[model samples]
Target: MRYHINFGQNSSSFKLAVIRALTGILLMTALASCASQGAQEAELAAQEAARVAIEQEAASLAQEQERLRAAEISRQQQEQAAEQARLQAQRDRQAAEIQARADAERRQQEELQRQVRAREAAIAAVEAERQQKLDRITALEQQITSISASVGDSENNTEFLQQAISVAEELLDVLASEQEKYEDTDSQGNTLRPLAKDLIAELEARKDELIRRAGTQ
Candidate 1:
């Protein structure tokens, strides 16, 4: 018997796949159209690697889901086989934990990659701006102008971080909204703590810098 995934076109999984495809396509298009051959080659390399990684992950997910469905069917059929059910339950739990880890790590990697790409694009914009003013500006003046531009770009970045934090908070609330069960420093908490900690540190650092810059101004 064949099993089908029931996630519809409107589902988050489908949306995520569309987003990933679009992102990869956009990145590769940008890399291909890059004016500088050196940058193009470098980005092409990175794009290929990312493509390979995404494909591998897709394959793994498909296999894992199939395995999960088969195991569920077997469990349902062998409800009277207590010993077999016990072993199957243990395996199912382990498989679930492994899948969760893989999903979390992939998400973290993708988020970090997007952040890096955003920063690089921002830096490129600042560099282009600096180049435009280079002929008329002194070295120190150009540096100052670039710094100002980057600071403006950082403000946009801060907003993205704020939105991410808000989403994370919402997810935390949803996970803990159990009626009878109490969750503590469990898997979700463990996954979130590092991210929350890092976000706070980065926001604090940005705040301090902005304060210092304001004082100078």
Candidate 2:
């Protein structure tokens, strides 16, 4: 009986030792697997972070390009506007200059002062009709030289003194027809409107030959 008891105690101790060894091996393997999983997860997280940074950088580049394009367009628009304004100003200046010139000759100096006052009123009405035909030809040459020297002595009625010598030779042919009408002349150098109507018909034929030689003296 004492020997059997000692054997039984030895068997129990061996079984316990086996159980402890198995537990230790299982725990070590589990720990190694967990550490490997953690390493893989860390690597994956680092790769993802790099991808996100690349995407953000690409977006920034695109935005910068768009901003530059918009600025260029705005600058071009401003340049065009400035050019238009310059052209408009030039046109206005030209128009103003034209208007000034138009008032130009101020109606060509009022039409040469109305043709010098109508040629000085037609030369003062032809010098007042040539001084009234030179004062009726100096009073008909002093009455035909005093009736041809008083009808050559007064027996006066030889048929009324021969009709008073044909009425004093028709009053010396009517004062030579007013000296041939004041010596003619024409072509606007005045004088001939038929020489003032033949000097008013030789002063009415020397007043009818001095009333027919004073009715035969």
Candidate 3:
């Protein structure tokens, strides 16, 4: 009876040990499953953060590219404007040079015309002086011819003297008529006085000689 009692007590202790071990194993399994579920949630959060960062980087890159394009377009417009201004300045300078050359040519033509007028004026003055000299020479020649005719009549024979007397009388009558035309004017006509007096003296001498010869006959 003592031995059986001791065996029974030992069996009860063993069964209690087994029950405690089973309960400890079940608690360990539940704790492991909760840890695994927490690990999966942490991994999903990290992936979502990485995706958001990538989207932000892409947006920034697109904006930078748009800014570069706008800056290039503005630079091209400035270069074209500068080229157009340079061309306009060159054309204006060329037009100014042409105008200056035309003005110089006009002045040269006016100077040439002035020189031609001066030359013509000089020639006209010379022609007028020459005409005046010709008129003075013609008057002197007529006076000399009349003086020669009067001197020749004074040296003649009796028959020639009678014929000379008649001729002298006719010439005296014509001279008296011409003298009456100048009677109202002064001796400022000094050239006509000497010629008229010489003709009158010749006619008087011829008439006296003719009367003397006729009385002797």
Candidate 4:
């Protein structure tokens, strides 16, 4: 009876031990499955973070490219503007030079016209004076002829002396016209003097002779 009771107790303890071992195996399997699921979730989260970082990096690169392109375009535009300004300035300078040259030419033409008018006036004056001299010479010649024809008469001699003094004064007036020929170049037309030097000397001699005769009379 003692043996049988002992066997029964042993059988009961054996069954309890088998049940405890099965329960421990089931708990270990469940813990392993939970660990595996956590590991998978952590892996997915890492993948998602990597994708987000890559997208951000790509966006940053695209924005940098856009900024660089904008900067380059702006620089090109500035250069074009500068080139346009330079060309405009060059055109303005050319126009100004042309205008200045035209103005100078106009002034020169005006000055040349003034000189021409002045020359014409001087020539006219000289010609008029010469005509007056010729008329005076003709009158003097007629008077001289009459005086010589009546030379023996006493009244005629006195009249001849007075006529000679008048002729001398007329010749003195002509001397000033001849002097002006040298002073005013426009009057000197390729000759040293309008009248010959010998003719002037003869006239001077005639004047002195006439003056002496007038004083004696």
Candidate 5:
């Protein structure tokens, strides 16, 4: 009975050792599984953050390109407006120059017309004056011829002869005055002074003959 009791106690101690070894192995396996799961979750979070950063960078680049395009369009519009203004100013200057030339030509034409009218009026005035002088000369010649005819028909009458001498003297004085008006020649190129001198000589001789005849009667 003492040997059997010692064998039973030794069997109980071996079973307890086997149970402790199994518990230690199970704890180690659970710790290794939890660590692997944590590492996988961290890798996934890092990938998500990289994708968000790339999207934001692309958006900023697109905005910069749009701003540059708007600035180019504004610059082109300003250049076009300036060019149109320059062309308009040039056309206005040309129009003004053309109007000035036209005005100058019109003034010149008006002045020329005025000068022509004045010249025509002056020529008409000269012609009228010449006609008046010629009519006066013809009337004087007719009066002298009528007086000479009456004197020839009344030669024996002493009163008529004396009157004829006085009349003839008055006509000679008038003819001398008329001759003084022509220095060189008349308008028709006639020697009016020489003809008037000859008429005065003939009238003077006739007046002397009438004076003698009056004394005899």
Candidate 6:
């Protein structure tokens, strides 16, 4: 009976040791599964952070390119405006030069017309003066012829003879005065001075003859 009881106690102790070993193995497997899951989550977080950084860098580069394009457009607009202003100034100067030339030509034409009119007026005046001088000379010659005829008809009457001598003396004085006025030669290289001198001498001789005839009558 003592040997059978000792074998029963040894069987119970061996069962307890088997239960302890199984519990320890289960705890180790749970710890290893948790470690592997944590490593996978960390790798996924690192990939997400890299993608966000790349997107932000690309957006910044696009903004820089837009700014450069705006500045170039503004510079081109300023250059076009300057070139238009320069062309406008050149056109204004050319217009002013054309107007000045036209004005000078108009003034020159007016001056030439005035000179032509003045020359025509001067020629007409000279012709009128020459006609008046010719008329006066013709009248003087007719008066001298009439005086000589009257003197020959009245020689026998003493009172008429004396009057004829007085008239002839007045005529001789007029002819001498006319001769003095013709000091310069005419355009034809002749003068009325010699004819006036002959008339004066003839009248003086006739006046002397009339005085002697009147004293005898």
lDDT of 2 by residue, 62-173 (tens): 8988998888998889888988888888888888788777666656666556545544544455555555545544554564455455556554523443444454455445
lDDT of 5 by residue, 78-149 (tens): 889998888998899899899999999999899888767766665565445445545644654564566556
**lDDT of candidate 3 over 7-122, digit per residue (tens):** 78888999999988887887787777878878888888888888888888888888888988888998988888988888998898899899989998999899888767765665
Give the clashing pairs for model 5.
none
Estimated TM-score for each candidate: 0.27, 0.37, 0.45, 0.64, 0.44, 0.41
- Summarize candidate 6's per-residue lDDT along 147-194 as a digit string, tens digits: 455556755654646465465647545554554545544443334344
Once fitted onto the true fold, the runs of candidate 4 whose alpha carbons sit more than 4 angstroms away are: 1-15, 139-217
- Superior by TM-score: candidate 3 or candidate 6: 3
* Candidate with the greatest TM-score versus the true structure: 4
lDDT, candidates in the order shown: 0.59, 0.61, 0.61, 0.73, 0.65, 0.63
RMSD in Å for model 3:
16.6
Regions of candidate 5 where Cα sits further than 4 Å from its true position: 1-50, 126-217
lDDT of 4 by residue, 1-217 (tens): 3543578888899999999998898888889989999999999999999999999999999999999999999999999999999999999999999999999999999988987887777677767766665675666566555555545556735765666756655665665566566554534332354555566677767866874675466
Model 3 TM-score (2 dp): 0.45
Q: Quote the positional error of residue 115 for candidate 1 in Å.
A: 1.2
Better of 1 and 2 by TM-score: 2
- How far residue 157's Cα lies from its native spot in candidate 2, in Å, is 38
Among all windows of 10 consecutive residues in model 5, the one with the lowest summed lDDT is 186-195
- Estimate the lDDT of model 3: 0.61
Task: Give the TM-score comparing model 5 with the true structure, all chains together.
Answer: 0.44
Candidate 1 residue lDDT tens string, 81-164: 887888989999999999999999999999999977877776566445434434323432443444445555566454434444
**How many Å off is the CA of 73 in candidate 1?**
25
lDDT score of residue 189 within candidate 4: 35
